[model samples]
Target: MVELVFITPFVTGLLAFVLPSALSRQLLVLTGAVHLVLSLLLWKNTPQAWFAEYFAVTPEGLLSLLVISLLFFLISIYTTGYLAAHGLKSENIFTGFMLLFLSTMTMVTLSDHIMVLWIAIEATTLASAPLIYTHRSGASLEATWKYVLICSVGIAMALVGSLFLTFSMELGGVTSAMSFSALTPVAAQLDPAWLKAGFIFIVVGYGTKMGLAPMHTWLPDAHSEAPSPASALLSGVLLNCAYLGIFKTNKIMVSAGLSDFSGTILIVFGLLSIVAAATYILKQTEYKRMLAYSSIENMGIIALGTGIGGLGVYGAVICMIHHSLIKSSLFLSSGNILMGYKDRLIANTGQMAKQMPKTFVAFFAGFAGISGFPPFGIFIGELFIIMAAFKTGHYLAAGIFIFSLCVIFAGFARQVMAICFDTPAETGTGPAADGKDVSFKEPPGMIWPQYVLLLTSLILCFFIPDALYQTIVDAVHAIGGGLQ
Candidate 1:
């Protein structure tokens, strides 16, 4: 299983580069099927799975691999239909990079060494740059440039942190061994000063990539400009990759007796990210940009849950899964809308339901799911977060949480009303697209993928498995004391 996964993506990536468009897409879809099947087989054969020095599955790693691989498969299916509709069967760069992204993510999820994780994570930033500029539009080029520059610099700090972590081990008279499971046992013996420094740098580095507040400036621009498929991968899968790095490190921190330090940092950034989203979403003119802010808000909530610990971490895991599903659905549906027509002001696009009812309903429903509607996965996750806040005696944080959530809902709802419901013009106003005639309906290619993704998210809400939640609980338990 390990060799198949590890070798398949790289080899297929090269094949994708040379194959005809039809063949390239076929290769991707084939790989996706194999991954989906392997994921299922792994689920049935669940045990302490390992591949020498290269890959291993802790409980957390297993879950990460499963979710990411499954999500990648779904996204690839959507990409196929999406590109074909646009008459772009598959460019060499496009198919090659898709495989590269998959390979990078697989490397990240399967990595046992902390340094290997860092390397794989950085590679994502590099591989995704071309995907961002795939359109070759000026806006896309600018966005891609910013993404590369910012993420590259952020990842450099992660490298520095990696070095510090290595130095801490060396100072403890430990050899260069750096497997997570292996290093974790001896974290307590590491030097306090060096370990603390390493943790801070690591957070700063990964936090940038994770779109944590203050350092998250590039996210909206990139998401708004990139192709919708790439945007979906960025929000739905890439952020999770960064989050996993933080999770692994925090696990070590807890063992080294650094709970408060790590927790406080997470809480501060999480709250700031939420606040940033609220402020941005209130008047975000661009529909795609609005979704970008929504991603930031979701990332904030995830971090908030992680920072609070105990039940909060478990809640975070739920939120992570829920957010991935809903955000991708939302972005894909938004792409449906955007491709049909382009506009900055939501008010300009009118009566979406009349034109593309299926797309409209899917977009609205996705928004509702992301906004924490009842029976949706996010609602369950948020409910857990609220419960955790109360249990931890954090009345202020709880109050703020509810208030911020309400504000976010109101802001997004306002936009939904404009784009999804209102008439095209305000009274006797001009056309939605710079006074040019435009269509209300989205293409079939666009609508199908979104519907599939939306239904998948809704399904997650219904089948909330105890085993899944238990894995999260175990992962959170590992975060206890943040490597104390």
Candidate 2:
């Protein structure tokens, strides 16, 4: 079952390269459905990987797999319609890369060995590179180059971190397998200095890929330049895959009684990322780029929550889940807005409610959810995180967190109001291309996916299923996280 989760997509991706464009698009959706179903089955039964040393269904892995599977499926649907409208020159390449991207992320989630995880993450960088360059424009080419180069360097650091982890095992004279499951019980015996160094390197390496501050230089460019579906995957699930690596390593650090050491680093980096994102979001001109900065801010929040542990870790899990849903929905809606306006600049967009009412609903609701408004999972997640911070005597950090949230909300709200209510004429911007002739009705494929994602976020806010709630608790428990 574990093999099937990735193998299906791998095979279909190869087929996409050879098949006609039309058939390849269908293959993409078919593969997504199969992958999602297989992932659900694995979650239901908790199957072992065919290669236990390299892969397994840990609770954390299961949670990531579920998000990747569901998001890919919905995004694939959006892609079919997206491709039809955009009329790319090489649709087959785009389709193939998307499938391969899915396979690599699945591999990241299931990987247990440190080296194998590094390899899988590196593969994701390679697979998604072409997708960012899909437009083949000068700007996209630059974005793709920066993405590949930065991520490759970061993944190399992760490889070094893996080597350090192996050295830690050797220094302690432990003969156990180097897989995460095998190491946790004996983590106390590992050399603390070596283990702490390994954790630092792992966090830096994977944090770069996760869009944490000081190492997130490539994210805004890559996200703003990539196609909307690709951007959705990058912001929604790819960052989570990187975070899974850090999360797993932090678990090892906790088991080794270095929680303070690891947690402090997480909190510091998390705060920096939020501050960095808040600065740029206030001045952002492009809507897609604004969303990219939002991704950075949310990543920071997740890191902050993970660092605080206890209820904070639970809150991080909730935030991770909801951010994927809401942020991806926003990116897809940006696609709709791009399609209608043919412009990416926020100042060039206006009267969304009058011009594109369907997209307006999805876009505005996504904005509300992301701003941590009521009836959305993010609001609950942020609330828990704030309370947990106070409980943990992190009053200064909590105060900073609240201030950052307000600044981001104010910036995001200002932009959203202008987009939804302000008329182009009033803003001194001319009408959009085809503004007078184009129908207001957006394609169901493009619009409905966002609706479904937002609705799921809403429902989860009100009620979570017993199985899922348990899964969340189990995932957090590995890192000393609990309700108390």
Candidate 3:
């Protein structure tokens, strides 16, 4: 049953390749639903994997799985409406790859063995690279190639780090299984020097894919060029999959009593990412690229929170959850803007409240939510993180965190306001390249998914179920993190 969660999608995706385009779109949605059901069942039962050595259920893994399952289902719904509007010739191929992408990400969540986890993460790159190229435009092609090249290089470094981890085991004369679950209990016995080396390489490698600073160059282009649904998944769940690797390794570091060393590196990298994002976001002209930078900034926040531990770790997890929800909704909303305006520039698009009223509600609300306004989960998450930072005596880091956030918020608001309220030039009323007027009819299918995601985040801010809360607690507990 655990394996079935990913296998079902993989098999269905293969079948989608040969099926009719319309049927393939249906298959994409059906696969998402089935995957979600299987994920829920696994959550309820917490079953052991058939291949216990390579895969197992963990608290963090399950959390990521649930988010991926939910987002994929909703994104698939949005994709249906998007496909209908664009009428791509390779719609079948697009749907097929989307399922494959889901399958690989599910595999990432379930993987336990270090090598198997590496394989799964690498497979995600393969599955998703094609999705970035779905449009086949020159810019899309460049973005796809850049994504594949950079991520593949990063994965290769991660493979070397995996080998280093095993070597660490050998140096300590440890004979444990090369799986995170198995190694964690005996992590203290591993050689400190080799362990630290492995952790550094692993962080750099996986961090690259997770959209951490410097290595995040591939992200803005990829996110901006991919189809909106694909962008949602990339920003929403895929980064989490990469973070899972770093999180697991950090667990081993905590178990080995090397938390300070590991945490410091994470903190430095996290701050660097946030600062880099702030510099670019203020100057960004393309709205999608701006959102891409926002994703980078949020990833940094998650990294920083994890490094802080205690309340900070808890806050990081909350940010992770809400970031996925809000960012995915924002990306979907960006798609609606793109469809109506036939442009990606913020300067050319305006008066969304008048032109696309339904999307305006979602877009503006998402803007507020992502900016960390109250009633939104992100606000709660960031607040907890800042409090934790101060409690831990990291005043300088906290100050930097707050300052970067404010800068980012100002930049984000300027762009969002231009899009949502500012009136466009009279030429904006002209026909688009598709021969449709600037007022493209808004589809409920596209509009509702964003709303559902935002609503879920809003509800979660106020009330979290016992099961979900416990799962989050368990994940943080492994890293010496707890609200208490």
Q: Give the C-alpha lDDT of model 1.
A: 0.80
**By lDDT, highest first, what's the ranking?**
3, 2, 1
Using all chains and alpha carbons, the TM-scores for the candidates as numbered come to 0.93, 0.98, 0.98
Model 1 alpha-carbon drift over 4 Å, by segment: 46-51, 88-90, 426-445, 465-467, 481-484
Candidate lDDT values, in order = 0.80, 0.91, 0.93
Clashing pairs in 2: none
Per-residue lDDT, model 3, residue 90, is 81
lDDT of 3 at 406: 96
Q: Which lDDT tens digits does candidate 2 get at residues 123-178?
A: 99999999999989999999999999888888888888888999999999989998
Q: What is the lDDT of residue 229 in candidate 1?
A: 83
Candidate 3 wrong stretches, greater than 4 Å: 425-437
- For residues 201-238, could you state the per-residue lDDT of candidate 3 as single tens digits? 99999999999998999999999999999999999999
How many clashing residue pairs appear in each of the predictions shown?
A: 13, 0, 0
lDDT for 104 (candidate 2): 97
Instruction: For residue 254, give model 3's deviation from the true position in Å.
Output: 0.3
Best by lDDT: 3
Lowest lDDT sum, 10 consecutive residues, model 3, at 428-437
